[model samples]
Target: MTIKKLVEQIEAKKSFLCVGLDVDLEKIPTHLLEEEDPMFAFNKAIIDSTHHLAVAYKPNTAFYEAYGLQGWRSLERTIEYLNERHPDIFTIADAKRGDIGNTSTRYAKAFFEDLQFDSVTVAPYMGKDSVEPFLAFENKITILLALTSNAGAFDFQTRSLEDQELYKQVLQTSLNWENAHNLMYVVGATKAEYLADIRAIVPDHFLLVPGVGAQGGDLEAVCRYGLNKQVGLLINSSRGIIYASQGRDFAEAAAASALSLRTQMQQILDAR
Candidate 1:
């Protein structure tokens, strides 16, 4: 889908929420373990319950990779289900994959073609050659990792190089890449203070921001600095929403959690 369509969805739903499908079998309700594909079953339940409340669903590839063949199958089925039933909802493969030229091409194909995700997260340390391949796909976004939510981000992302923070350089340099309009970014909400500077670099591009709920990132602070006229942010809440309950009412609890965030988002939109 185009970024225009994504913006339309956010406006129509009064939300820019992206529900993370980082499903952990151990954390899911025990009852689902009996299903032929417990991971997909749990994901389906959450997606069905909260589809109206979210504009995107991100399934970190590691979750599926850990389970081997069955896990991969679950991931495939999950994407197919979303495409068939909720095609409007943006899909992200949070694989964080990057490699040399040829390798990155295959990685892009795996997600954008094989899995058919609307976007995927990629590490940009390998420079332009590593990311340009993903941008080749029309209408597909390549969300490069910038300042992340994890504590370890400060080690390199914030370090000054040539009198500029490395992350800032990444954003500035990306503008020169081919088809840069198809590019988005992963800016961790935990570092909300950095959003202002980040936005100054690329104010119109979409930001796939995680660390909002479970990691205690302030939603208001993120929006104060990050939101564009198009609502250029997808605030994700994984464990905080999907695992709101472990009992029979798990789906209901998940919906409640999503609703709370969506309501807050609506207020922000109205204020805008």
Candidate 2:
């Protein structure tokens, strides 16, 4: 999906919520295990229940990769279902991939052409060569990791090099790359305070923020500094929403959890 269409869905739904489908078999409802593909069954139920309350769905690749071939197939089926049934909603493959040029291009083709994800999260540690391959794809978004929600981010992301934080340098430098207009960023909601500075640098790009709810990142604080003219933020919630219940009403419970966040998002937009 294009940014214009994504923004339109946000406006129409009164939400910019991105539901993280980071499914873990051990944590899902046990009843779903009876299905041939438990993971896909769980995802389908959640999507069917909460599609109206979100503009995007992100499935972190590690979750699928951990389950081996079964997990990989589940991931495929999930994306295929979304593309065929909910094409209007954005899909992100949170694969955090980065490699040398040739390898990166193959990774890009796998996600952008084969799986058909609208966007994919990428690591920028390898710099321009590793990332531009993903950016080269027309209409597909390359969401680069900037300041993240993880505790270890301070190890390097905030480190000053020549008196400038590394992540700031990343944000500024990435803007000069080829097809930079297709760039979005991964800025953790836990790093909300730095968002004003982040916005000062890339005010127009969308930010995929993933530290709210279960991670305790304040939604109001994130929006106070993260919102741009286009409401450039995709606040993500994973375990908090999907694991709201492990009972038979799990899907309904997920919808309620998502609705709670979406209602708050609507209020934020309305007040703005």
Candidate 3:
């Protein structure tokens, strides 16, 4: 979807909430295990229950890749269901993929053509060449990793090179790449304080923020520094929402959890 379309969805729903569909069999309701494809079954229920409360759904690829063929099938079915049903809801394959020339193009095809994701998370460490291939695809976005939510982010992302920090350089350099306008960023909610400085460099681009509920990243603080005129924030809550309950009312509970975040988002948009 275009950024304009995404903005419209947020306005229509009174939400910029992006639900993370990082499904885990061990954590899902045990009853879902009885289904033919437990992972897709769980995802279908969650999407059906909570699609209105969220404008985006991100599925980290590793979770599905780990399950091998069965896992791959589940991932395929889940995306198909979303595309066939909730086409308006932005889909992100959090693959964090980057590779040499031809390889990168194939990766792009795998997600954009085969999986039909609107966007894919990509590692910026390889610089322009590795990322531009994904950007080459029309209307598809590459969510380049910047400052992440994990504790290890500080090790390299924050380190000063010459005078500027590594992550800052990554942001500034990426803008010069071909099709740079198609770029969004993965700025973790835990790194909320640095958002103002990050915004100084790339203010208009949407930020796919993780680390909110379960990770204790302050939603208010993230918005204070990160909100652009378009409300360029997709504040995500994965485990905190999807795993809100492990019982029969799992879907209902997930919707309730998502509703809480969406309500807060609506208030923020109202005050804006």
Model-by-model lDDT, in order? 0.93, 0.95, 0.93
Best by lDDT: 2
Tens-digit per-residue lDDT, 143-175, candidate 2: 999999898999999999996999999999999
lDDT of model 1, residue 268: 92
Q: For model 2, what is the error of residue 198's alpha carbon versus the real structure, in angstroms, after optimal superposition?
A: 0.4
Q: What value does the lDDT take at residue 266 in candidate 2? A: 95
The global Cα lDDT (0 to 1) of model 1 is 0.93
lDDT per residue for candidate 1 within 114-146, as digits (tens), equals 989999999999999999999999999999999
Off by over 4 Å in 1: 214-217
Tens-digit lDDT track for model 3 on 1-272?
89899999999999989889899989999999999999999999999999999999999989999999999999999999999999999999999999987899999999999999999999988889999999999889999999999999989999999989999999999999999989999999987889999999999999999889943349889999999999999998899989999999999999999998988888889998
User: Pairs clashing in candidate 2?
Assistant: none
Q: For model 3, what is the error of residue 147's alpha carbon versus the real structure, in angstroms, after optimal superposition?
A: 0.3
